[model samples]
Target chain A: MTPIKGLVLAAHGSRLKASNEEVTEFTQVLASSLIDQYKHIVPAFLELAKPSIEDSIDAAVAAGCTDITVVPYFLAAGRHVREDVPEIIEERQKAHPHVTIQATPHLGVSEALKQAVIHLL
Target chain B: MTPIKGLVLAAHGSRLKASNEEVTEFTQVLASSLIDQYKHIVPAFLELAKPSIEDSIDAAVAAGCTDITVVPYFLAAGRHVREDVPEIIEERQKAHPHVTIQATPHLGVSEALKQAVIHLL
Candidate 1:
């Protein structure tokens, strides 16, 4: 059983171009750091921007990933994280039933982020 | 001059009660750690919830803070951060002309958070 075949860094894309670009910029940083561990690391948007979650999932599968983990770059487990993202993934699953998709908790609850924010202050 | 007289860990409150609560929960963690440095640390909402930016600003002034900092707990500097939040702070400034109200960049682009996400991956 291979572990963490692919990783998707999903964000709630913004309407403002600058705001959305920041997510893409941060994703590049993450993609670089994660290159050693993950074969396919992609940045995707939930809405209001390019590369919606479904497209990201398709890319992962196209890159020969059978099992993928989608980590929402959101602050909390909102409906988008809890419901919307999963629904998108589910639809993708219909096309690639062999693939295994997992969703991680949003970045909001990550203790690492909590500690980081504290350190930032 | 008082250094960081007060702090507001501001969030884009969600329609989902659970999602909005997570911001409050994170704010408590931030408040607990920041209490030593800041006399007042408040959790405020940008919209869709209670104790908005204006109310939080009022509270900070009421707490005897002359120079206050509002830190947006958002992933990026969207229209809300670039326009809406500044407008709110401007209104508050008008109400409390003597108080020094400042708005920090949103939580996005923080090297600390970038490091945290890298470690998390």
Candidate 2:
């Protein structure tokens, strides 16, 4: 069986401590829920938050994972989604050529999201 | 017709300046697209960004809007969603009891969001 390695939840970290914790807690909950399939689930941040994308990717590689999937925990396809993330991915790919990297998309407007918004309304 | 009023996009403005501008730009684009229905679409920030929610709401009321819809530019249901926003809404409601206020939900993981994410992948 192809070794299913790591799932990395990447977020834009906030300088506010509580905000950082919020994203970390969310990632933890998500990781726990996906424990069955993913042997390892980690949280990384673009800034402010700890264990940044670079560190998380390196950690995953160091932990004997040849494959990593990066999931961006963002709402829109802004500069971070359009530029920063891809640049990071390219850098990581070059640094760890043997490791396969897959970057998921930003969480954009969708039915479920719209419904969630409606529920809040 | 009841004076169709304003739509406010509330975001957590970043100190990084560019981040704040990005959200502002996105809100402007959305507003431009929604001009037919909403006479005014304004961008507000919880912090850092200019034109706070309080200010935007006040502007809407000043502009003779009896109803205002606040859409949170957030990705998940965190403390901001569960706590901070409700307090702001309550305060707004009390201040402008005659003005109808609607607080929409955070853009949680949904089909559309998921699809958008997938598209990035």
Candidate 3:
């Protein structure tokens, strides 16, 4: 049987409700685009929000995902991205050793984002 | 005589020094790319960082820029983008009546950013 893949869009949650909602909505949009590649796509928050990284990972595992990818949707590689999110991922990965859970670089470091900023101007 | 244009990349300032540096460095890269269009391109903070938006605008005016654009380098349109940043821009525009100052939408709302996120996957 083919391994079921899962994806997580990890974001730095905001105190503002709308801000968190925007990430959730965007994740839905992203999930639709990646329907073929991922059986499950979830939006997880670092702080001040629901469905945290650990919870998201566990849920993906429960959903029978054999492989998972976490992408940080942040503009900078701050402590949250560098330390907090990674720590959560590390813990979750150990808890579910059978599942291949890995994190990609945060969004800010992407060269594509730099080009996008120029295009916005 | 042509009006000298200035661009301000306004970001949500971080408490982490390295986080702030990343934004400042990105602004420099952006400035290099926009050299032909803008006489001055500066990075400014909303809070928790140095070189506040008001100061950046004042410096741009002092540097002989008659027109300025402030682009909020933020992932979400939170209180900072919707209210705080705009309030500062409004106050600064009135303070410098000779200078035309305006703000663009925050980075998150861009369709290109959505595409970029997909590309990263």
Candidate 4:
């Protein structure tokens, strides 16, 4: 049987609940847009918010996702992006060796961000 | 004489100097793209970094800019975006009525952001 593919949008969570909600809401929007490609697109946080990255990965694995991608929804590479997130994902990968767990580059590094800024101008 | 136009990219500053530098570097890239329209494209921080919004506006005015736009480089409409930035800009506007100072919608609200995410996938 073909395995299910899942995605997790990992964000630098905010103290403001509303701020975190914005990330969750955007994750839903992404899910809607890529409905065919991913069975689940979950929102997780690194700190100061609920559903940490580990929990989200566990949930996805429990839901029968054999392949999962964690995309950092951050603008720049900080300590969290450079050290924390990758370390967590590496540990999780060891625990779920059968599952293909990968972390992509953060959103800020994308060329599309430059285009977005240009579009605003 | 034609009035000079300036732009300020206001970011939620980070303690990590490298992270702050990323925003500054990106502002330079934006400046390059908008060379014809804006004479100066400066980068400022809400906090935890140098060159506050007010200072950027002051510097731009000193540089002979009659019109300036402050673009919030944030991903969400949080307190910093909704309250702090506008309040700062409002006070600055009052102080510099001769200059047309305006704050544009943040980068996150742009449709280009969604397109950027799509490109990532």
The prediction achieving the highest lDDT against the true structure is 3
Model 4 TM-score is 0.88
- Cα misplacement distance, residue B75 of candidate 2 (Å): 0.7
- How large is the interface RMSD of each prediction? 2.0, 5.3, 2.1, 2.1
* Whole-model alpha-carbon lDDT for candidate 1: 0.82
Per-model TM-score on C-alpha atoms: 0.92, 0.66, 0.91, 0.88
Q: Report how far residue A20 has shifted in candidate 1, in Å.
A: 1.4
Model 3 CA RMSD to the hidden true structure, in angstroms = 1.9
Model 1, stretches more than 4 Å misplaced?
A1-4, A119-121, B1-4, B118-121
Model 1 chain A poorest ten-residue lDDT run? A112-121
Candidate 4 C-alpha lDDT tens digits along B36-116: 999988999999889998899999999999999999888777788889999999999999999999988777545678777
lDDT of 4 by residue, A1-121 (tens): 6979999989888788888888888888888788899998899999989899999998999999999999977777777778889999999999999999998877664567878877766
Q: Is the docking of candidate 1 incorrect, acceptable, medium or high quality?
A: medium
> Per-residue lDDT for A93 in model 4?
97
Q: Distance from true position, residue B35, model 1, in Å?
A: 0.8
Q: Which ten residues in a row have the lowest lDDT in candidate 4 chain B?
A: B107-116
Instruction: Give the alpha carbon lDDT tens digit for every residue of A1-121 in model 1.
Output: 6754788888888899999889888877777777777788878898899888889989999998888888878887778988998898788888889888878767875666776666545
Model 3, runs deviating above 4 Å: none
TM-score, B chain alone, candidates in order: 0.90, 0.92, 0.93, 0.93
lDDT of 3 by residue, B1-121 (tens): 7999999999888889888888888888787778999999998998889899999999999999999999988887667878899999999999999889998777764566767787776
Between the candidate structures 1 and 4, which one is better when assessed by DockQ? 1
